[model samples]
Target: MLLNLAIKNFAIVSFVEIDWQQGMTTITGETGAGKSIAIDALSLCLGSRALANTVRPGCAKAELTATFDSSNISKATKWLAKHDLQQDDECIIRRIISIEGRSKAYINGSPVPLAQLKELGQLLINIHGQHDHQLLMKSQEQRRLLDEYADHQELLSSLKFYQSKWRKLNNELTLLQQNSQQRQAQLQLLQYQVKELDQFALQDNEFTQLETDYKRNSNAQQLLLLSQQCIEQLSESNNITEQSSALTQLQKSSEQLSQLAELDSAAAAIASLVNEARIQLEEASKDLNDYQQSIDIDPQKFALIEERYSFAIQLARKHKVAPEELVSFHSNIKKQLNAIANDDSRLDVINDELEQCFSQYLEIANSLHKSRTTAAQQLEQQITNSMRQLNMPDAVFKLAITEKQLNEPANHGIDEIEFLVSMNPGQPVEALAKVASGGELSRISLAIQVILAERIVTPTLIFDEVDVGISGPTAAKVGQQLHKLGHSTQVICVTHLPQVASKGHQQLFVAKLTDGKHTQTKVTELNQPGREREIARLLAGDEVTDSSLANARELLAS
Candidate 1:
């Protein structure tokens, strides 16, 4: 149940604090007295969209807070606990809207997303606006109402899951079927590319090695000539008797230095250096001779290395890749070919999965159909009885459920639901929009709300002038139904009818006051005498005559 509502700078209400009570509370005011301001404030706290215009003139922001007692509301309590927002039995929801059109929501002093606030709000209260009956004309709204009344959430969730899976698989199958010819053509191209690459058989890092081998083999003759010249200059000349080679000159110098060393110690060091140079020269000459012998000038081997290197460059150009990247490119082509080869098997798998999803969807949908069928019967009987009590003794309400076309599958299932009604005896039932007059529609809407209220577990229900098209004894009946509903849950009604106002266990009067410079709305709880005067004002306009006061007292007495 709603405990209190505090609103600041909201609409024309500068600041108002309303302490709500148990049972039915009627809010009465003149036409422009801002009776619905409280409702609008509560709606904002419940996650309704807020606009900058909702703030009072010249105000920076608007703030709204709603306090509820959630001890008996198990669903709300569980939700609070799950969200880590629980604070014992008290649940407070607050909303602040800035002039910049930004808003914030809080639950139990903890910031929350607007969606979470709305979700928790649904478990706390259900508001029925004056224009709610207008929504009943829509077929989708009719289906939703029926489903809500039947509590088919679990079945609907299962059906939705299967429907989503079925749609995914069906889309895959369609794509595969549409692209089969294109896929076949692509497969042939990829197969040819893979086979060509296989014949070339390029190995990793082989391109660099091929270049090295080709260069080395092409220069083998030049390398051999250079080695022979070095060997002849160091050790032997083309004329063997020519003692002008580097090794012969170094050996003669060493013998001369040895003889000088006996005369001076410095000459001894110079003799050792000359002997080391001769020894190094001889070893270098031997290495050059060995290298010249190892060089091969075979043209056949050089031709093979050149051909391999040239072919690798040509293949790289043909594949539009660097010479080193041909190996990876070839690997990718083989992978594409393999994927295309598996497409036929993938098509078969998708068909099987689509069939399975359809079977599951149909199973859950059928179960939901049965549940709705049963709920419709019960709802029809109850609303019919309620309508008779609301001064429509001959009204008949029915729910029509028919199958949709086989090809027209929908996420909500394959059923078309419509509300049917007949307003008079011998009048064939027709669609609600076609048969019900404005007044009759309002009464029917009220009847349905009253009946559904008995089944709903929400702690509070707010009706914002839902009795607009009703009057006289019918207005009294609407009041009685709301009052009766209050026995099980808290009911708040904003009304203009004196009969309805008289039925409330408590009454509040909304008055718009102006001080030349400012206009504001104020709500005041009415005591016995105050209630009588307010009801009189509602009955006889602003005059509040003695006769109207007597009538107000008589009505309250009943």
Candidate 2:
């Protein structure tokens, strides 16, 4: 239950704190005395959008806070626990809006987003009023309320899981059907690439060897000719034996120098030079003979090297890669070919998987549809009994379920269910919101809310002059219904009828007070005696005559 509400800088309610009780509480005041300010503040605390103008004049910001006792709100407690914002026994929700258009929301002292506040707010309060868009009037809202009462969330969850799976499979099938030609074109390209790679017939290290051999053999003739000249100069001459002739001349010079060595030291030095020159010439002749034997320029082998070099370049250009990538190209093409060849088998497996998913989804959806059909009948009977007690005895009510065609996954079923009604006995049944008179609708809504309070988690309900067009027995019935509903939930109502106010467990009176140029709105909680006096004033205006006071006291006693 909502225990307290505090408002600061909110319209004419500069600062106000209201402590409330669990059962019915009614607020009464003269017109335009700022009674609606309390409702507006409650709305903001429950996550309604706020305007900068809602702040009192001369104030930069407005603040509203509501404290709720969540001992009985299990789901709300769990939600708060998950978010680390649980306040052991009570939850405080606060909203602050600045004149510069900045807004902030908080739950249990933890900052939260406005959207989160809005989502959690519905769990604590519901307000029903005249000239108000009540939730029961809308088909979707009606369905949700019934689902909440019946605890059909698990069934709805299953249905949603199915819908998501069905959509995914449907999307995949469409994509594959539309892109089959594209896949075929890709397969053809892959096949052609594989054939091109096979024809190249590349070998590892073949290009390196071919180029090396070409470079060596390109200068083979020049090397051979150079070696022949060296051989002649050293040891291979036919007419002139070059190395042998040089050796013989050196020996002759050495022998003559040796004969003169005993007579002169300079002749001995000349003999040593001739011996060294003959030894170096002999080694040079041997090296030249080795070079002539090793050079080979075979025409067939040279032709093969040239052709292989040209082929390496051609392969590189055709495949658009360096010579080293020839081996890699072969591996890539083979992999693509394997994928294309096995594609049909893989596609069959995918199709089978999607079929299984689709079947699972349909099965879940059908189960949920059946549960809703059964629950609707039970819910119709319950609401009918409630409305009869709210002074609409002759009214006829029906739960009309029509198959919805929008293809959405509804928790109830693949159908739209409306709360249809006929206010008069002879009239044909029509939509409840359209056919019921204002007063009848008020009573009916109260009855439905009373039934919902047990199932819904919200702790507070606000009725804004819902008994506006009612009086006498009808007004008394509205009071009785509120009294009954209040036993289980806290109800805040703005009312003009003493019949309703007298039945409330608590009463607050809104009045205008003037000080100099300032006009302020004040709300005060009244004790039993004060409440009777206030009701007397409501009945007989400012006079509060003897009969009116006596009647007000009688109402309190009753």
Candidate 3:
């Protein structure tokens, strides 16, 4: 229930605070006295869009706040707890609109996004504006009303569950189908690449080793000629006798120095140096002779090595990779080929899953369609009965659910639901929007609200000027209906009719007060006598006669 409402700099309402109560609280005022200003402020607190000009003439911003007692509103309390915004049993919702067109919302002193405010607001209040009657013409709204009346939350949940699974499978199937051709083309390219890389028989370190062997073989003849010349010059050259060779000459010099060293110790050091030099020359000659014998002059083997090296370079260039990295590249292509090979099998599994999901969705949708059909019939009879009490004595209401033609499953089941009505007997039922008058529309809307009152989760219901195009016994009936609704929930109504205002357990009078240069709106709760006078004013217009006061009293007593 709403406990308090505060408004500041909102339109012509500079500052106003209203203390509200349970049951029907009717707000009455003369035309242009700002009766709707309070409701507008309430709307802003509930997350309605605000205009920059909503701020008063001299004010920089407009602010509105509503305090709700959440002790009785379990849904609201649960919502607050879910969002971590709960503050005791009291929930304060505030909205501020700046003149520069910026808006901010707060829940229990916590700043929140507008979307969150709107979501939480729905769980707290249900506002039926005068124009809400036109929603009867919308088929979507009609379907929603029937579903609410049915109260088959479990069935609705099941339907949603099936719908979700089906959509998931459907999306996967579409993706696979769209990419099937591309995947096949990629597989073919991968296979060709794997085959080409396989023919190379590439091995780690093999390319480097082969290149080394190729270079050595290609220069074998030059290496053999150079080593043979060195061996001949040092040991057994054809140009010099073996005894006259450098190695033989160094050996003779060392032997003669050794004899002199034996006679004189100073010569011993020179003799050792000569002997080490002779030993080094002999080892060098032996190394050169061994290298010359090891050289291979085979032309065919050298050509084979050269061809292999060129093939490796060509393949590496073809794949746009370095020579050493070709082995790693080959491994990658093989892995891709294996994965592509599994696509067909994976696609088969996905198709089976999709089929199962589709079957489940269809079964649940069919069941949901049956339940909605039964609920629609019961809803039509109830609303028809309500319309009679609202002054449409011979009214007839019908809910038409037609099957939708589709190649695949749809989201909201298979039926298109609409509400049809006939105002008088023997008349064919037509779309409510086309035939119902403005007054008839409001009354019909009220009747539906009354029927669904017990099922609605909102703790407060505000009827903003919904009494338009209604008066006489009809207005009285609307008032009584609102009063009945109030028995179950808090109802605040803005009205110009005394009949409706008289039924309120609490009455508030909205009036405009003006200084010479400024105007402001205020709301005052009327006492018994004050309510009587206001009702008298409503009954007798500008002048409140004695008879009008008597009539107001009688109306209130009734």
Using lDDT as the measure, which candidate wins? 1
> What lDDT would each prediction earn against the true structure?
0.89, 0.79, 0.88
Candidate 2 per-residue C-alpha lDDT over 297-398 given as tens digits, one digit per residue, 9 for 90 to 100 = 898988988887888778788879887777787688788678656665556676776667656655665665577678778877887787787777877778
- Evaluate residue 66 in candidate 2 and report its C-alpha lDDT on the 0 to 100 scale: 90
TM-score of each model, paired residue for residue: 0.83, 0.71, 0.76
Residue-wise lDDT of candidate 1 within 1-558, one digit each (tens)?
A: 999999999999999999999999999988999999999899999998986579899999999999999999999999999989999899999999998888889999999999998999899999999999998999998999899889889999888888888888788889889989999999888888888889889899999999888888989988888888888788777886666888878888999999999888888988998888888888888888887888888899889889989999998999899999989999998888888778778997887787777878877888888898999999999988999998898999999998665442468887889999998999999999999888788888888888778887779999999998889999988888888888988999999999899999889899999999999999999999999999898888889899999999999998
CA RMSD per model (angstroms): 5.4, 10.2, 7.9
CA deviation > 4 Å runs, candidate 2: 129-137, 181-187, 190-362, 402-412, 426-428, 512-520, 540-544
Worst 10 residues of 3 by lDDT: 236-245
- Higher-scoring candidate on TM-score, 2 or 3: 3
Model 1 TM-score is: 0.83
The deviation in Å at residue 471 for candidate 1 is: 0.6
| Predicted model with the maximum TM-score | 1
| Steric clashes per prediction | 0, 0, 0
